[model samples]
Structure formats: structure tokens, C-alpha cells
Target chain A: MSTRRIHAWPVRLTHWLNAFGMFCMISSGWGIYNASPLFAFHFPTWSTLGGWLGGSIAWHLAVMWLLVINALAYLLYGALSRHFARDLLPLSVSAVRRDLFAALRLKLQHRLGHYNAVQRLSYWLVLALGVLVVLSGLAIWKPVQLHGLASLFGGFDIARYVHFFAMAGIAAFIVLHLTLVLLVPSTLPPMITGGRRETSHE
Target chain B: MSERKKAPPKLEPAQQTQVVNLQRRLLLRSGLSLGALAMLGGCNLQDGDQVDKLLWSMSRWNDRVQAWLFSGQRLAQTYTATQITDPFPFNAFYAEYNVPEIDLDGYRLEVSGLVERKQPWTLQALRQLPQRSDITRLICIEGWSAIGQWGGVPLRTFLERIGADTTAKYVGFKCADRYYSYLDMPTALHPQTLLALDFGQVALPPDYGYPLRVRVPTKLGFKNPKHIVELFVSNQNPGGYWEDQGYNGFSGI
Candidate 1:
């Protein structure tokens, strides 16, 4: 085994911070939603963060600053470092289709320091979903003041649905991401300690 | 035969015991780590703890941000009469049956704090003031919203007429139903803000605040106190029923 740099410091920092922020936001959001649910079913109490509606709102509004600031930092680093372009871009439909089939067949290659076509596409999609959730959140939070943003999602009522679906997309992406990490266990060390390549076998 | 050969290597009893011990250690480590993480996150802390204090301060910071974002000139969207939500949902801290019943003849709107006129206002006096009607959306903190046609005196005109200190930082309301809420000065003076007396073409039903309520289109519904009995202007925030319980004081929407 050899050690090398895989994930940059900025990437690791933002990744964990965003993880924490999203955990707070999503759990508290469930609490807030249960107050006057738009849908029929309510999120189970065990899955919720804050104990009550008021407590949930306090946590949600508080964590909002952290998430927004962390997102901005990630975006700036991704742009200035060309990290997004180098890692997640230039994805094509054919490459994704090929990778999808290979993955399903358990024939996909696991490279130590690179993302596959499917990984790239999923990362890009989750990033887009993150942006969407934040924008829709802002629209609903200040519908009258941010009328233009609210109207973009058809209106305040629809914006809530957009926020929910975007959250669901991000949650799905997280599940897929964790499953991949578990399947490719060697991938986990690099994310935490920068890199540790086990070169005994493919 | 080749596949059998590939699976020839098997763990001996000693090695199997070692693996079991390793798994047990891993589980214990993970359990401890999870406990530590939850503690560090302060998720289990009670109210008035460091976490709660931090959350409260952040909520207040959000209030300041919302206040800064507020504009006097930007009007909330208005709809036509036909667009109003038919049978607008009744909401309060209490059930509909508990909606306060105030005698209209004996009712007097108390005005105090920085106002030149300390006189109480009658329903007739408020009615006689120049009236306007607006069909605007009432957004609740609970995430539901409804469009209602509200008719009454513009709050700004009422403040001016009552000789209120327009420069006051806070305008508080005491409701007949014992529910209370307050608004920031900018919201208090917004042109769309109404001391609403009528819902639709007729007088406001008891369920909808009877003879008086605040109709602030820009704020979340909680800020619009119903069956208002006392109106006061002050430099200090008197806090609110829900707000004291931890809801954001300035919930603008």
C-alpha cells in the first residue's frame, strides 16, 4: 500500500460540513413539515430532529446560514481549482450507458483516483439538486420579497414541492453514494486521509 | 473442479475466532463513535443549553436579515375578487369554537405608547376612516397559504390618524382571544397593511376575527393578530406568544 493525495483539503472540508448541514436541515425540515403537512402521511417521529415545530424551525433557520455559506465555498473552490471540470464534467450519454451496464454486471473497474462515467453524472446531478433545493427554499421563505424567485417555480405553493423533490433527489444520491463507498471499501480511506492505495491486487 | 480449487482456502477455527473478535471490536468502536458524535453535535441538549442559545441567536440574526431585506415599496401581489380562496381556512392557536366574541358596542381599541392620542377608538371611528380593500395571499408559518379579500383602514393611515410615533421600532398587538403578536416598524407602515374589518363584502365573521384584525400580507399569518384589542408602539420588542416559545419573531414571507 502507498499513500498519496486523492481528495483535496477543500473538498474534504466542504464535504463533511455539507454533510452535517444537510443532516440538520433535512431532519429539522421534516419536523417543520409535520406541522401542517401538504401530503397525507407524516414523517415518523424517530426520523425527525427537533422535538417540536418551533424547535425545528429554530434549528432549520440556524443551519441555513451554514449550508448556504458552505455551498458558496464549494462552488468557488470547484470553479477556481477546475475541480468540477476535471472530475465531473465531459460526461456523455454513451459512457454513462456503458458504465451502467458494466456496473449491473459487476464488471465495472474501480480506479483509485478517478470517477467513472456514472459517478461523474451522479455527482453533477446531486450538485444541481443542491442548488435547486436552496433556491426553492429561499423562494418559499420570502415569497413576497423574492417574488421573482417564487414565480420561477410557478409560485410559493409549488416551490415547496420543488424543495421537497430536490431534497428527495439529494437523499437518493446520498444513498447511492454510500452504497458505492461500501462496495468499494478502499475508496473510503482516500476521502478521510487523502489517499491510501492498496496495490496488492485489482 | 477449477471453481472448487478457487474456493479451497478456508479460515481455520483460530482464525475464525480472531475474525469474530475483530467484528465485535469494530461494532463496539462504531457504537462509541456514534455516541460521541451525537454528544458533540449537541442534539440531545435541553432548551437553554449552549446549543439552544446558539440557535436562538441565529434565529434573531435571521430576523435582522429579514428586516434588512424588507422594502416598504415592494407590494405583495394582489388578486381579483374571483381569485380569493373560497371558504378560507380558519386558523388560530385555539379551535374555531374558542374564537372570541366581543360586544361591538362596548368594544374600544386601546392605543398607547408614543402615540399623541391616548384615546380609545370605537368601531364606528375606524369604519369612518378612509377605507381600502385588497385581495392578497395570507401565508402561514405552517406552510399553507390562502388568498382572501380584506377590507379596512390602511394601518399607516390609522397610525398617522392616531398620532402614533411612526418612528417607533416595534408595534405590538394584544388580541381579544389572548393571543398576541407584534410587527417591525417597516411592516407596520407598509401600504398593504390593513386593520382589516371586513372579509369579502360583509363584516368579518367572529371566526375570522370579528370586528377587527391585522392583515399583513408581507408577514407570515401569525404576525397578523386577530380580534385586536390593544395597539401599542414602542422601541422595545414585547415579544409574542409563539415567539416567546421559539418561533422566529420576524417571520416574513
Candidate 2:
């Protein structure tokens, strides 16, 4: 077994920053949602981020810049390093199917040098959804000025739904991600320390 | 392992072109629209201790963008009287109980700046202006919205009557409750923007800006300053209460 750097410092930093920002945003977003609730049920105030509508908006807007900047930095790093192409790309359908089955059977393998197909796919999907969430958020935030963007999503109301659903999707992904991390405890340390000890399969 | 050995499927030329076109359109739209703001400073995000300044500058840039997008002719969507929220929520920086109670007998709206007439018009005189009414939604920055029927003189007409320099860059308001805000000249002259004296077909209530409030349906609720006691047209930027605190001045949505 050898200890090697599995995640870069930038990656780790951005990941935690994004996690904190998203947590603040989603919880505060719920508080905002409570003000003019679209759903019948209300999110418990204790579980929400801000104490009131004004507070929620303040938190949401502040965290928004955090999320945007960190996400963009992560993206730029990934692109400049060719990380996405070398590691996450070429997501063949067959690999996805096999990886999904392995995941379901609790037989998924962990590798040091690269992500498994399921990890790659999920990461990519989450990234894409994150971009969508940001776009839809902008549309809702400036509906009239960003009228074209709003119209692309159908309309302002539709953009709101898109933003809501996208956030929900990201929240769901976080649940699954955390569960996977817990199940494979060894996976968690590398994200924090940026290195992992792995045994050579050969 | 055997399944992974197979090559990925290929898309037909038509399908490939469609995908490329879609991507291009999305890129172009965001680039052209958001580029104005994103390109303003071009400052590195990692600039330590300068992030707040950058963000504030971006907010101001966004204000300019929204102002540019605003058109005086485009009216805020109107609703029927039945659509009005029964209890249009009372919202302010302070609690509802703290809503200022002005002395009606001495109430006067002092007009100033870039205008030929700097006369202080009393509430009675303001009421004499041709009263127009509309049922429009007031959107708050807090993601809530409510429809209300508001009646008052059109701000454009009043601005014109007062000889306000319509060419001025900004229309600023000072409220008796220590609240102040301003709008871009275009939004100030918007057909739907009103010096609202009545709410729900009655004299404006205290909780809502009593005596006078600027009802700008095109902008977020915060941009619509209530309990307005003074107005001025200016070429210089008159910072708003929230706007100074990082909220966008041109908060149109």
C-alpha cells in the first residue's frame, strides 16, 4: 500500500467552500420559500438558516457570491488541468450500467488513480445541475433584465420551478454522496487531507 | 470489463449539429447578457479583503444593466381587483408597530433638485392630480409576492408637472421614517410608477406607506420607498438605504 495525493488542495478547498455555501443557501432558500410557500408544508424554522425573510435574503445573497466564485474557480482549475477530460470524460453507457449495478450490489471497487464510472457520472451530473441552478437563479433574480434567460426557461414562474427542482436535485445528490462516503469510510479522509493510502491490485 | 471494452456510440451528423447549436445558443445568450456585469471589473476573485468591494461594484454594475433594460412604456402586469391579496403583508425594516404616524395637517411633499419648481405640495394638492389606479403585484426581494390595488397620480405626470428634469439620471426619495431610496430616471418615469395615495381603493394605510409612497411595480418592494416626504431629481447618484448596504439600486425584476 502506498499513500498518494488523490485530490489537489484547490479541489479540497473548493469542495468544502462549496459545501458550506450550498448548505447556507439551501437552508436560507427554504426560509425565503416559507414567505410565499408554493407547497402546503412549511420547512421547520429550527432547521432553516435565517430567522426571517430579510435575514434569509441577506444570507442567500451573501452565500450566492461565495458559491459562484468557488464553483467557478473549481471549474477553471478542472478545465486548465485537463482533469475533466482525463478523468471524468468518456462516460460510456456500458461503464455506467456496470458501475450502477456494482453500486447497487455493494460491490463497487475503489481505485486510487481515477474515479469509478458511477463516481465520474454522478460528479458530472451534479456539476451540470449546479450550472443550471445558477442560471435559473439569475433568471429569477433579475427576471426583467434577464428576460431572455427567463424566457428560455419558459417564464419567470417556470424558472422558479427550475431553480427549486435543481436545488432539490443537488440536495438529493448530497444525501447519496454522504451515504457513499460513510459506507466507504476510507474515501472521506482523502477529500480532507488530499491523499489516500491504497493497496496495489496487482 | 467486457462491456467496458466496447466503444461509445456515435451521434448522427444532424443530431451532433443540433447539440452544438443548442450549446452555442446557451453560451451566446449568457455571454451577451451576463457579460456586461462579468466583464466590468475583470478583477481576480481571489483578491483578499477586496471581495466586498468587488461585490458592491458588481451590484452597481447590475443596477446599470437593469436600468438599461428598463423601458418606460412596458407596464407591470395588472391583475383584477379580485386578485388582490386580502391582507397584503406589512413589511418594513422595522416592526409593523413602529410604522411612522405623520401629522396630516402639516404633511407636505418637498420637491427639489433639477426641477424648475421647488414648491412643497401638500397632501391635498397631490390628491388633486388626476388619480389613476392599477392592480399590480409588489414583489419583495425576499421571494414573496402579493397583488394590491393602488391609486395615485402617475409619477411621470407629477414629475412633468413639477418641471422635474426628466433628463436627470436619477429620481431620489426621502421618507419620514428615515427610509430613503431612489430609482433610475427611466423607472421613475415608468407609466406604472405612481405616487400612491390610496391602497385597495381607500386612503393609504399607515402600515403601507401612509400619506404617500412610491409604488413602482416594475421594481422590487424595497425600491418602492414608502412614507415619502421629499423627492429630488439628480444627475448624481443618491445612495439608497438598502442600496448603500449592498442591495442593488436598480432592483427591477
lDDT by residue for model 1 (A1-202), tens: 2443578889989988999899888988988899888799899866776566777777788888999999999999999998888778889999999999999999999997778899998998998999999999999999999999999999999999999999899999989989988998998887788775445542
Q: With candidate 2 superimposed using the best TM-score fit, by how many Å does residue A101's alpha carbon deviate from the native? A: 3.1
Instruction: Give the CA lDDT, 0 to 100, for residue A71 in model 1.
Output: 93
Off by over 4 Å in 2: A1-24, A27-59, A62-86, A89-97, A148-161, A182-202, B1-74, B80-82, B93-106, B127-132, B167-169, B176-178, B200-207, B235-248
Q: Can you list the residue pairs that collide in candidate 1? A: none
Over B202-241, each residue of candidate 2 has an lDDT whose tens digit, in order, gives 8999998999999988899999899999999999998777
Off by over 4 Å in 1: A1-4, A196-202, B1-48
Candidate 2 pairs with clashing backbones: none
Model 1 compared with the native: what TM-score? 0.89
Please give the interface root mean square deviation for model 1, in Å: 7.3
Give DockQ per model, in order: 0.27, 0.10
